[model samples]
Target: MNAPAYENGRLALMLNEPRLPTIGRFWPEFAERSDKEGWQASRLLGALLEHELAERAKRRIERHRTESHLDPTKTLATFDFGMVPMVSKAHVTALATGESWLEKGATILLFGPLRAGKSHLGSAIGHALIDAGYRVLFTRTSELVQKLQAARQSLQLPSALAKLDRFDLIILDDLSYARKDQAETSVLFELIAERYERKSLLITANQPFSGWNDVFPDPGMTVAAIDGLVHHSTIFELYVESYRRRKASDKQSAPATITMEARQL
Candidate 1:
């Protein structure tokens, strides 16, 4: 029945209390509505709290998506599951929910040749995971390797990895594109080893596990990295024709491509 004094409310705002802004904005309307409709105080408070929580959730989802570095255009809605028959829509949907593998710190490997929708699928799942309130980071394998190498040079590798540890999931796109340099591969292995069983990884690669030898300098390290990755992992082998090539072919087959000369005639 009692309300905080104006000075006390100002102090709460200065102290940055949660939901105070929402309460301040809605309390008068809520009171008026309750009085007019004979609503209970408990019901009004519950509605206000629910609204505050929903706002907080929306802000958190926005922050996660911005920090994730995922491609905005690539999302589950845009991904054509029928076009990539090699990939299972059910399996992708399950993973996108970030329930089983992501929770258990397992890996999801998308293996296929170029333009097989690997990057799109991985990024779409990253977006889904972001919506599901999971922190995610999407980076190209080469860019990540370069960052690690730079961190090693600066003697800040530990700090870098520690910062990376904050993310629940990391989407490494195009894993096989990174050059097979010893320094780069070493730090890449360190990242894999550090996150082993601690965080989840979603990788899109153009090469299979056996072909990873071309990406690593030493066979032993390659095996170790592969072991750590696949020990608790789900592999999706996408062996369809290149999506880009198919699109090009469709464009070529379209009837709208008549020459300007023909139109003029």
Candidate 2:
């Protein structure tokens, strides 16, 4: 018998031919069909495996807090840099491009008044470093003192400082916000000394080095801490009106308030 007109040869002939077993029972045709389905299934499984692996990597970063040791407390969601000077999207892009924000043991000082976006800038940088697979630690100046106090009582000060090195970026937010005693100021300096050449730091304060003594309590230690940080750091001073207060005023004067929902395109 002549083969089917569309036949390429034996394989096509089998798929196209009428047979005793019927079209559904054509073994060669079914075999080829099964193979194609299997190939597709294999591809689907491979893609699933890759996705799972990526998820696991993210989880590992979350778990270690030190493996790329990023802080879980990044304030990226709270910051909106509208009219604030110093940090910008361009700065973050450069960071993501692998530029070192903290270079060669330099300190970074972000000074401004309350609600001046100081913490926001530091938090944003921390998030950026995390995305770039670098470790970051975030804490307010007061929180850091509390941690040091606890570490001291437990005789874990050195160990705690050792763990601090696990992060590539260390942010001491809200420095000079609340006043502190002598011992606390000493502890703060020690932590900085520990991180000096070993890692990077981001210090945010309401006042500059000259006014640090007002918050630090101990003049000598405060001066030393300021020296340690400023000796090798860049300082960004924000001298604008508080965005927080401005928004509050706007909301109060508005006839109605509206909340917007984020939509996927």
Candidate 3:
């Protein structure tokens, strides 16, 4: 075994670089073949780095998909369609397929019962935009209003609104889910008035405009809210059942989703 001193010399040359994990894993073999495969190590190292970079990009895209649309807090897999509006599909297809038409600030709305697919549809549209590499944002109606107020309280409301405008499509989910105080209602109207005819908007609400008085409190504010929201909006009224309860009834861990139109008018 001690007869070949040349073998040890060849091993030393191949083992020269110990930094690369890929190379270190095969160090012994590489060292043995140093003379015949001397240039191969450098080429192999380059290839390894390229693969790693590509994988990293893939992970980043996936994270964006989840964060921007799916909402890391919600699960799309749990969306149930058993209670989706019958006519919801047509409007959704128009929005999803005709995203190009959104440049002029087309609007979409979802008015439905609790446990219906309002937020789901809104998020789904947001997800579609994200898939197309377009900018999108989703926020609960109450939460976004609170954020705007918080920004104003901190003297940064304008800065916050500027970022809102950056997104091509913004989904305001669960707008009337909770009763709004007078101040919150006024802030909500102001935000709507600003976004009106400026960008594509998706709003989901359980209460119809006729019930607006309860939330807006002021008759004038109610008119303002409705005018801004409906002037350039596609309104969807979902009279469907509770998709969530449907799943509960079946005792199926998996949910079945339905996408249908609520009504045109």
Best by TM-score: 1
Candidate 2 — number of clashing residue pairs?
6
What lDDT does model 2 reach?
0.68
Global lDDT scores for all candidate models: 0.86, 0.68, 0.69
User: In candidate 1, where is summed lDDT lowest over 10 consecutive residues?
Assistant: 11-20
Stretches off by above 4 angstroms in model 1 are 1-19, 247-265
73-117 in candidate 1: lDDT tens per residue?
999998888778877889888888887777678999999989998
Comparing 1 and 2 on TM-score, the stronger one: 1
lDDT of candidate 1 vs native? Answer: 0.86
Q: Which residue pairs does candidate 2 place in steric collision?
A: 65-69, 66-69, 68-135, 106-232, 107-232, 107-233
Worst 10 residues of 3 by lDDT: 256-265
Model 3: residues with Cα > 4 Å off, grouped in runs? 1-63, 69-85, 88-90, 251-265
Q: Please provide, for model 3 over 1-265, each residue's C-alpha lDDT reduced to its tens digit, 9 standing for 90 to 100.
A: 5765556556555545543334434545544566576657676556556655666556655765755645643333344444563654555655775356467677788888997767777776676666556667787777888888888778887788777887777788877754678876676777777777777788888988888787788899889878877777777777777766775777653343222232322
TM-score of each: 0.87, 0.68, 0.66
